[model samples]
Structures are given as structure tokens and as C-alpha cells.
Target: MLINLSGVDKDNYTLSILKSLEKHNSGSLKITVVMGKTAPHINSIRQFAKTAPFECQVLVNANNMAELMAQSDWAIGAAGSTSWERCCLGLPTLLLVIANNQRTIAEQLQQVGAAISLHVQEIDTPKFTECVAFFRQPENLAQMSEKVVRLCDALGAKRVAQHIEDLTKNEDFANIRRATLDDCRQVFEWRNHADIRQFMFNTDELIWENHAAWFAKQLGNPDFIMLIYQVNGVAQGYVSFTRQSENIWEWGFYLAPTCSRGQGSRMGRLALAWAFAELGAAKIIGQVLPHNIASLKLHEKLGFFRLPEKNDVAQFELSLDKCYIKKQFHSRFKIE
Candidate 1:
């Protein structure tokens, strides 16, 4: 689902893309544009299309988004926030990376072979046509679609619940226990790092005093549960869960700034497994911005299913009773 956070400039790129689509005008290709939150840009697009084909349609709201994307072959979407929704649905895309904030995500998606990122300067009529034509090649489109299908097969919610199950199953992997108040000091360091903050919600660098206040407030919230991860008895990272309600949890985590040899996913899975099995919850949800490719992949790996989307952050869920563990338990031991 494309969340039009482009604000007033929403239709500029979509219109350009549609103009290119007209040039190709393949009867087989069906396209739909979903406009959200009163969709101011719809009128602008209407003005440009003199005659609308039966295949091209526009929709509003989250409910229609999944249906449209499911029915269509591919999506040409904004790069920043809407990207996750596309990934969550396993929809391959040709991205228009419209903002500076989106560069990291665009590069990551390209690295993983999930998307092609186009600059605004490179988004003219010819380039757009070429992208559409290139993907229309059945083999190329299938390969790209396969990547998305694998990455987003389950909507992302279920993966998280399964991860929690993993953690609970291997309780010994809870390497760090009895995290003290001082533990936030270490997490704060990573939170304030340049590379870490770049992908984060904040733009400016973090000040210790201000950062500490935020950390304390987050830690203090009864809804917020923080757990530190360690190896060889040293603090390496942390995992956090927000008890969203009796039935839901919002989760996030970060490893130490320098510790990037793929250990984060393992730790995440362990922590997630713990949450679902031990925390006594019906479902676990994760809200991720579109740009976090690693996190997106991790979510996919853990079986979190994405909801039909509406906003910048894609929503994924995992139901405990339906998770893989339950299925396995029922099969292996016939508990069910």
C-alpha cells in the first residue's frame, strides 16, 4: 500500500510514471494507484489522463491496498515509508527514492535484490518507460518477485512470534540476566552513534542528558520491557518490547555499533521467542519504517505477517497459537 506522505507533491512522480505506462500500454498490465488520507493528488492525476483504461484504477484507504497489490503484477512506489508495505506484501517494486532520508533503504533494497532505486533526476519519461519495459520481461520480473515473495511471504507478524518462541525454547541463550539501571548507559551509546541515528527517527545528534531522559522514560514505562544481550559476559546489545496491550506488543532492538557480523538476527530471534512464549501474549506486532532492510528481512525470517498497510511504518503481527512452534508441537508430540 502506497502511503502518500509526499504530502502536496504526491502525484508528480505517479503521474510521470503513468504517462510512461501509456507509452507501453500493454493490455495485460493492470495498474492501480491507492491514495490515502483524502488523497489531494488524485485530482491532479485525473487531469492528465484523458481516457482511463479499464485496467488502471485508483483506490483510497488501507482495506483496498492489499487487494490491489495482490491482483497487480508489480508496483511503482515512493521509496521512503511505503517501501516496507510493499516488502511486507512481497510485492516487487521499481522505487522512486524521493527524499534524502530514503537513500540508505534504497541502497539496502538494491543490495538484497528486492528493488531498483531511481533518482528524481533519473525519473523522466524515458527512464520510467525503460524500467517498466525491463521488468515486463517475464524472467527478470519473476526473479525479483521471488525475492519479495521470500522476504515478505507471511506479512512479518508471525515471524516475530516464532522468534519469541525460539528464545523461550532456548532459555539458556538469555545470556545477560539482571540488567541494572546502568545498562541503559550502554544502549544509549549505540543509540547516539552517527550510523545508528541516521536510520533512526531523530535527525540531530543525541545529547547524553536528553538521551538519558528519553531512555529513562522508555525504561520506566510499565508497557516497555527492555532486555540486554551479552556474550562472554560482556554487554553487547539490547532488545526492547512495548507491551501495547493485553494482546499485543511493539518490539525493537539494536546491537552494539561495531558488532555487525550477523549476530543481531540471532539475538533478535532469541529475544522474540522469549516474548511470545513467556510474556503471556496473544499476538506480537512490530512497526518498522520502510527503510530498514535488515530489520525487514529479519522480520520475514521470523515469520511476522504484515497487515494491509496505510501509513509510513508497515504493521506486522504474530499470533502465538498459530505460530510454527504450536504447529510443530502438535505434530511432533500430538499435543493438539
Candidate 2:
């Protein structure tokens, strides 16, 4: 049985989570609702859950919540204490973040495949119905369970716990080298800033610290990478990497303080060139929002060719050994 109370009635977003759960078939998977400790309109959530199709459990004491969740294979909870408990127990959890603090944790968990975190605004009735039908299938549940186990192993609870400990102890910012802890802070700050946050994939309007924490989790994951470019002792811009596979990497770069003077196209080229030559990457991919003509042109200048549109997003590819690239290298690396 999976349950969540955090989104009961007060939060329209949390309500969507409950609605999605309620629509699932209960014969195979018993669905329920248990309100979080922080829910303001707890009485309203309880009333809604009582009328909910399946049995809805209520948490009288938050202290005993963990013991209750342990009896189940999966738990649906707020992206807070309950979620943390689920992570510790290696429970396949789903998140509905009702509070700002949970955004980073929810994102990090989703990144590692531990839980499913969907925004309320993006939740459509048809998609929710589809997800319920999909998860209700026996094979899908089993596959997801296996994925949760792998995620727990990949991002151990102890690592996150230790980070919280070090952070509370006033950890020094030094010793953070290439793609280190400090870089996460910078990347996160960049993402949360008014200008860049609007253009980001998450687009959640999260705090700068949340972005930092999310980036911190990605530093060690090969599937995610961040590189910063510094010139004359000032941080100019950053390049991000998300690996599609062993042979392919997806690239995204942005200049800080977009209003700052001069374009950072040269820095972008240098970064991409280093990624191909130093990283030994075979192919690099980029995506441009349809309206972003400047970025589309910049990618073209770097020899990126178009790929089939997926979800209306413009996809471009740069192959390492293309004829044009070979010619340029021959011109530069030719013997005197």
C-alpha cells in the first residue's frame, strides 16, 4: 500500500498526488492516505481521505510513523522526515513536496531513481491515470522495486547523513577541486538566480541552497557533471554535462549575469573542445529551446548538426571525428 497525506486539501499540488493514488486499482495494490505532521489543514485532509475510495490511514503520532511504513513495500510521503525514513529503509517511495525545503531532496532522489517527483502544475488527469495504470501492473512494480534497491546502493543514506553532519559542523570550503562540493554551491546559486532559474529544466522556483544540495548529490555520479570556467580569477560561466551513455554526453552551458558585458561564445567553444579532446568523448549533444535563436546559432558555429525533434525540443549533435573537424585540426596540428 502506498499513501501520502501531505497534499490532502490545503495544497492543490499535494491534492494531485492523492488524486493520482486514488485512481489506482486497489485490488493489487492497497492505496491509502496518511497526512504529514506539517499539514496545516489536517482536518480537511482527513475528511477528504475518509471519502477516498480506499482505506485512508491517519498518523496520530508522527514518532511511530517509521514503524508503520516498515510493514509496507512502498510508502508515499512528503519529501521530509517520512521520505528520509523511507530512504533509510530502502522503501520504494514517491514524493509530493509541500514545502520549499523538500525540493532539493526530492530532485536528488528522483535523479538517482529512488522516487518519482512530479510537479503539481504539470499533473494532468490523463497522465496521472496513465501512471496509475502503469504502476498497477505486476511487472512494472517489480522493476521499480529493483530500481529502488539499486538507487539505495548508488546513493547510500549514510553519505547524505554524513554531509548533513559536516555541514552542521561548519565544514571548510577549501579542498574542493574540480567539480567539488564548492562547485555545487556555485552551480546551484546560478540556477536559482532570477535570470537563469527561469531557463532551467527544473523551473521549480527553488532557493539557492536547494540547488546547491541537488548539485552536491550529482558531483560523484558519472551520469551528471558540472564544469566552471574561470578567467583572470573571476568565475565567468559554467558548462554542464548529463551522460546519455558511455559514448555520448549531453551538454548545456550558460553565462553568469546574462546582463554582463560581452558574449561568452568563445568560452563555450573552449569548454566544448576540452570536453571532446580531454574527456575522449565520441559525441556531444545540445538542446535549444525553440525561441532561443542565439543559442541555436552558437551551436551551429561549433559544427553541431540537427537531430530528430523529441518533445518539440531542438536537438543538435557534434561528432568528434567529422570531416570538417579533421580539416581544422590538420590545419592547426600540421608539422612545420
Candidate 3:
């Protein structure tokens, strides 16, 4: 963990980290603090750190917050602009509102699962120790990390330009919206597309009459989520989620053959973000046909892990607590 109060008179926060490090198993955790250039308590803090039982360092400042923060899994500091740095670097944090001005963003970050906030008076050994143990698990840390990144990456700008002249291109969202009964025939047509049907578990062609009934049933089921994505107001693909347990959800997605290359991955991201952020899913599970190599690689790149085969179909799962999705927000490859 990296600690930086960012110029606030909050030496207690640093003390909490030191206490937690001592309570935790030695050699398992380390803390490095970036002190303010002129804080009055710098000398005392450094002296305390020197006698710490585990590894701890107190520095007056750092060359770059982003560069150093990237090397750590977690950060603890004042809730301010530095919070944005942690979010951008995919480093989760335990934030404290040192000043009245910092409370708003701190609360917002906490509400969205991006960071945990503590009252100034609450800084102590027990609270810090609790955070240490919880974040030690790979899964919990992974989930918190992604939640912070996704919250940070919510900006709509698509980094697709190859040259300065391309800046004027419109960035249309693959706007994901819920499906209505009016979308039945459109979805049915895509579902039975020769390319889509060949890979289905039940290869028998789906008849519209039966599909309409099933689609209507899904529209009324709260446990199921069906979304139709649009680009420039034209429907291009669809993704759906089905809740298995309280926190586990399964998803499937496909694009219209007429859609542009790379649309699948883009659409998939929108759905996954919604699943983890809005639906509060702890894990997402999926399956692919044995012949679907493209689908398997796409899932893997998005952080899904392969599970044992289920009746010839390949099963995959991604835990929010253990999200391994690549940091790349967009796919670079063009699908033919």
C-alpha cells in the first residue's frame, strides 16, 4: 500500500498504516508514504516509521504520483485530485476526507465502490487492520481495482484516431438499451441467421411463433436482462444476462453480420460494465461451443477464465473480485 496525505496535516493516517503493517504478517505487506514538502510533523512521522517492525518508508515527496502509484496495488491518502490518479492507474484506495472540500468526491467514490472512505476521527489501528485483511485476497482486490478503473474510464471519447485530422469524427456510443416486444422479430431474424444458428447448442432452426412467446416471457422476467445496442440509431447487436444465484450472472452476445468489425468486443464491454456496476454481480459465467475459437479468445481477453467442459461446451467464468480483463478499453483487431 502507498500512503500520501497530499499536504494535509493527517499524520494519523500514516500511523494507521504503520500499525496495520505490524499487525499483519511480516514480509507480506509493505507501505511507502510520500510526505508533504513542508508539513510540520514530517520529522516525527519519519522517526516513527524508522522503528516500525515491518518495512515502511516516509518520503518528503515523489518524482511522480502516477509513476510510483502504478507500482502498487492499493493507495491510502487524502481524497482529492490524487484520487483521480489512483483511479486512472487502476489502483484502489482507502480515502480519508481531511478537509471539508474533499468530502463530496470521497462520498461519490465510496458509493460507486471505487474507494472506501473513513472519517478523520476513525483513523486508527483496527480500521486499518480490517482494510488490510479484506484487500489481501486476490479476488477482492481485483474487483475493487476494476470498479475504480471502470468508473474512471467512463469518459465517452473513443481513442480511434490515427491522425490529428481524424479528431472531428463523431463518437457514437453503442448505446445499450432494454429490448421490448417490438424488437422480437428483429432479434428473431438475427438469432436464426445462418452464422448464429450453426453454433447454437440446439442447431435446429428457431421458428418465429415459438421465439415470440419466449421473447415475451423474457421481457417480463426480472431475473433476465436483454439489451439491444444501437450505433447511430441502427440496431447492430444484442447481449443478455440471466441471474443464476444472488450474485452470479451468465451472459451471451452476438452481432449482426452487417455490423462493422470489432463491434462485438465494444458491445461486450458496455454490457459487462453494467453487469458489474449496476447489477452488482460478483461473478459472470458463460459457455461457448467447442468450435467457437473466436468467442473463446474474446472472452479470455475480457478477463474470463476457462472452466472444465460441460457436455462438450466450454464453460468460462469471471469473478468481479478476480477480474482479469486487460486494461485495453477497445479492441485493436478488425474482425473480418
Candidate 4:
């Protein structure tokens, strides 16, 4: 866990967090705290670090917030710009609203189940400790992280770039990255969603045991690429490519149920571009349910041609040479 107190010189919130940690120490949770860049309360954090039994770090002007935050499973951060950064990484936070201006951001995130907002006036050991303890549950922890991604996608920057080639700057989407074991729980949530599962070739709610086993194999499989899409550093959707042959890949994707409509089209475009540009695929194919009209249209919009049904599945194919990516839909990578 990484606890960031932002730029506040002397915050009572840090003390509250430390006290909470002291009580939870026996549980074996390691913690690292960043006491503001120009913290005047450094003495307290440093002193606590020395006497604490659990692994604890007290950093000032802590190194790359993104990298540090990404490495952490949970954060107790001052509610501010870093809230968005947390959202991007899908790192659930117990946000301390230190300033009056921060309530709206904190509240909005809380409303979306992305975070828990606590007024600095109420900052104390007991309440903070309770929240941390609740998160210790595997189901609660996984759900909170999953909710964070729904509200802010870490891939927003790239998704926005896919629409505007000449734009110089934007924070609309987050960078897309390969999936790992840590993401299995979240992927399971997306996959098990009734809406998402219904359109699959096999429409069954996967049990955790089976899903975990399948997901583990996919992560290390060279023939499969599972990418998590983030908007503003929070995960919003999933895209994957499975190798069918030497020059062809089968692709599929789905947006979080809370995601907006037009974005699905954008994701398809981005995934297709990645298949051609990154993987150097000669062609890409999709298996669509005949009743799944939305996917059928999406494939056509992205230049996929209809083919005869294969084993009761509506088949679509896009040959690299004939693909016609939408004008507003651009690839994240440059087209040389």
C-alpha cells in the first residue's frame, strides 16, 4: 500500500493513517507513506517508520507517483489531482478531503464506488482502520478495484488519440498495457457480466476456479495477447487477440457496461490497428453471434466483411489490404 499526503505541509491525516497502521500491524500489511513534497510533518513520519514492526517507508517528494501508485494495491491519498491518477491505475483509495474544493471530486468518485471519501475533520484511527480492514476481504478488494476502472479508464489518452491524429496533447485516455495475474479478478468481473457473456460462443457464467485457471494460461501464452484499456488511467474495457495461424489472429472485445456507446467503436478501431501494426497480421477475424446486431454493425463499420456462418457463428474477416479504418478512428501508433 502507498499512502500519499499530497503537498500539505502538516496534515493530521498522516497521523491518522499511521495510527491505523499501528493497530493493523499484526495483520502483516506493509505500508509506504509519502509525506507531502515539502512536508513540515516529516519528523512524525520518520519517527514512526523507525519504531513500526511492519514494513513502512516514509518518503518526501516520493519518486514517480504513477509508478509508485501502480505498484501499490491500495492508497490513502489526499483528494486532488492524484485522485485521477489513482482512478487511472484502478488503485482504490481512501481519499482524505483536506480542502473544501476537493469534496466534489471525492464525492463523485465515492458515488461511483471508486473511492471512499472522508472529511479531514473526521480523520481518525478507528474509521480509517475499519475501511482498511473491510478492503482486506478478497471479494471486497476485487470489487473496489473493478469499480475504480469503471469510472475512469487509464486508456483514455490513446483512445482519444485514435480519433485525432494531429492533436498535440490530451488526457482523454490511458495507455493500454498487457494483462497480468493481478488483473485476473477484474477481468473475471467483466467477463462474467451477463451482457458480455451472452454474446460469446459459450454463454456461461464462469466459476472463479475455472476462470482463474484459464486466465493464468492466457497470461503466459505467447499466442494470446490480452490488453486492458484505460481511460484516464482507469480500466474501462478489454481487447484480446488470439493467434489462429501464422498470419492471422482472432480478435474480440467488450466495453464495461457503464461505458458510453461510441467508445466501443473506438476500441474496435484501436484493437484492429494494433493487430495490423503491432502484430503484423495479414488478416483479422471475428466470430459474432448472428443475433448480436451491435457487434455485426461494428465489424462492418470497421471494414470487416461478412462471411458465411461457421458452426452457427456469423463470421467476419478484415484483410489488411482492404481494411478501411474510420476517419475519426485512428491507431495509437503512428502509421509509417
Winning model by lDDT:
4
| lDDT (CA) per prediction | 0.68, 0.64, 0.79, 0.79
Per-structure clash totals for the candidates: 21, 1, 1, 23
What would the per-residue lDDT of candidate 3 be over residues 232-301, giving only the tens digit for each residue? 7788988899999999999988888788888777777767776776688889999999898879888987
Put down candidate 4 lDDT per residue, 1-336, tens digits, no spaces: 888877664645686677766776534777878766567778877887888877888778766788888888888887898898888888988888888899999999999888888877665556766787776677876898999977777777888787665564553664456777988998899888998998887888889999999999988898999987776667788989999999899998888878876877767777777667678888999998888999999998888889999888899999887865523334452322
CA lDDT for candidate 3: 0.79
Cα error of candidate 4 at position 135, Å: 78
Give the per-residue lDDT of model 1 (tens digit) for 22-67.
6666556655666665666777666654464425666555575666
Per-candidate TM-scores read 0.43, 0.42, 0.50, 0.47
Give candidate 4 regions above 4 Å deviation. 1-171, 324-336
Number of clashing residue pairs, candidate 4? 23
Off by over 4 Å in 1: 1-11, 24-28, 50-54, 153-336
Model 4 CA lDDT for position 284 = 94
lDDT of 4 at 240: 94
Note the residue pairs that clash in candidate 3: 139-321
- Candidate 2: regions farther than 4 A off: 1-177, 258-262, 323-336
Rank by TM-score, descending? Answer: 3, 4, 1, 2
**lDDT score of residue 297 within candidate 3:** 85
